[model samples]
Target: MRDIHIQAIRVHQYGGPGELKLEEIPPPVAGPGQVLINITATGVNPVDWKMREGMLARPLPFIPGVEASGVVIALGEGVTHLKVGQAVYGSVDGSYTACAAADASRIFPKPVHLSFEQAAAAGGAKIAWSALFEEGRLTKGQRVLIHAGAGGVGHLAVQLAYHAGAYVIATAGEENIDFVASLGADEVIDYKAAPFETQTGQADLILDTVGGDTLERSYQLVKSGGTLVSIAGKPDEAKAAAAGIRAVWSGAKSVRAMQEVARLLDRGLITPAVRKVFAPLSAAAAAQEYSRLGGPGRGKVVLLIE
Candidate 1:
């Protein structure tokens, strides 16, 4: 076995961004149906912060990131589909490191047009597709409402909904209203000035990226036979039935879905809203943490892991 010590971040106990620390750790090895990737870029998403904040179910003593773009360095048994040295991007366990061992199924070919940072940005966008098309059953010519339109998921959802022929409506702070509109939203709401539910009457589909009261209020915006999907909070089934709409909490860990996103990237049907990249794990983690808490919360915060 090759001895590999890599720079990585680990959370021993969840608390805050201050708890995230960089250390030298053994690089993950490819197991069955897995491939070892030499990570080039790592995406810092809300989930990373959420996981650190104890919002996720994953327990302590786990590596911190999930989205990365990298080159395949090794393949374990039954991983004949991809060759070593192929550039790939996808979601994986413990991706906040110089190398990651990921299930081969989740990895997808990186489109030639996308840089490593761009590919890393697609992680959240891919999950947004699953929420809108796969779970929400969004259709063309429908009215689609996407909350937090400038967010990692919402911006992509806006573009996806727009390209699908839906009338896209988005909510964002005043600063990002134009940014969201540029991403193809038919209408942009200044969510700070007014409540989104009061502005949008009804929608065929609703992607709720904002949870809490925003998620609860979304039930009113969904059309009679439409669906509201969220990656945030779980919905009350009884309330959904009463409102005559389907409420689903959706997520993606799908190979086919990642492939679909990759295809879209190749064709230029959708573009990721990537604003910045930080070099090194410690600085990247801190920058992402600051952005998640108080900085401009639009686009993706990526870590250049090389």
Candidate 2:
């Protein structure tokens, strides 16, 4: 273990945004099959706040972020694929801090083209790609409708489906309709102005990044034998059976899923749109932004750590 400490946001209790508190904590040791990292940046997702709110239960007082970009500082026993001083990005333990220890297989090389802030947002892209292709089984020449098309995951989903030769339709706020269109969405629907189901009737696939009523309504938009994959919440199986479709709730829970997205990112085929970046000390402000706008803002919220 290193005789050093790092600053990170820690939650001692489950509540709202105010629960996230900045603290000075000891640096973590890399366990076997893990690599220690000096975190450069962290991407804030719905999971972060959700976990803080006790929606996802974890042991209290742990640093919150998981999706991060950083440099390898140390390696654990039996780890061989990566070496010291290499730049990598992936889901890591207590990633809101200045240092982290992450799974070796799950961490990926930071693309030369993207800044650490951009690379840290890779988890969102990977989740979208996994939900659309791996779990949703999106195929070419089919119609895919993405809810919250301008969100952290939804934006990437739109691009991936479009590039995969799917006829892409996306629903967004009226303010982001053109932005979603710029990402190659063939059709854009303003969910506030109209019902998305009316515009996109019976799509082959529907990616639900917005849960609650969105998931419920999406069951109606999928054609028979189609699939509805969700990242926000688990879809209702009875509803899926009633609609003659499959409702899946799974995404990039593994590093291999992130590596696939890294390849696309390195090749410049896809990118994460970062909406706002907060300084390390401004974690509270970042949490407030996420709560005010939710995680589906036009892009993602990131924390810049020096």
Candidate 3:
């Protein structure tokens, strides 16, 4: 026990960003198989805002972030893979605080070439990798369509699929067409210009980060025997069955895939595009809101705790 308190943004009640309150709280201790971190930065994802809105239920007064980058401050009993003072990045349950404890396996050594902000920003790569490879089973030479190509996860999905030899087609607003294209997308369709289904031909796989109508429309674009994977929500199974394709909702966390993503990032084969970084931790509300609206900027939004 450190016998010290830290500032954190907690959600005492489920509502909107207004419910995210910054308050002083006791720093959490590392349990066995866990590591305590002095969080320097956190990645803002839709899941954070969704959890704030009560879409994902948790105990009251819990901190509200899932991905973070920081230095290891303490190691739990039996933990030896990582040493104190080493920088790392990984999935965290409550990252919206000055310090947090994470599963030892979840945290990976931060790449020497990556800043804490970049490491935090790159946390979404795990989700992207899981959706594209593990769930969607994307392979080389296959046509894959990814929605919201400029988003936190979508941008990374685009690059990963493209580099994997998949013919990458991504849907973005006109302003982001060139930006998504630069991320290795073979084609960037301006969704505002028209319905993406019409602009994009049939695909072997479709990764939907933007759900609802976009997901509903994507069913028709997957060829027979193709797969549609959604991290946003559950796809309509009836529609998928009728279309003769597979529709799956992916929420599973892949630690192995995250390790591979870290390797790719370290080698410079892929990179995170951090669009905006908010400072002082109090800016978490604004950062979450910016991520929710898919702000004027492209790629990930970050909250710099320092």
Residue pairs with clashing backbones, model 2: none
Clashing pairs in 3: none
Query: Which ranges of candidate 2 are over 4 A from the true structure?
Result: 1-3, 295-297
TM-score of each: 0.94, 0.94, 0.97
Best by TM-score: 3
Cα TM-score of candidate 3? 0.97
Worst 10 residues of 1 by lDDT: 285-294
List model 3 lDDT by residue over 1-306, tens digit each: 656789999999999889989999988999999999999999998889988998888889789999999999999988999999999999898999999999999998998988898899887678889999999999999999999999888999998998899999999998899999999999999999989987868999999999999998899999999999999889988889999999999886788888889889989888888889999899989999998877887888999999
Which ranges of candidate 1 are over 4 A from the true structure? 1-3
- lDDT for model 2, on a 0 to 1 scale? 0.84
Per-prediction CA RMSD (Å): 1.9, 2.1, 1.5
- Alpha-carbon lDDT of model 1: 0.85
Per-candidate clashes, comma-separated: 0, 0, 0
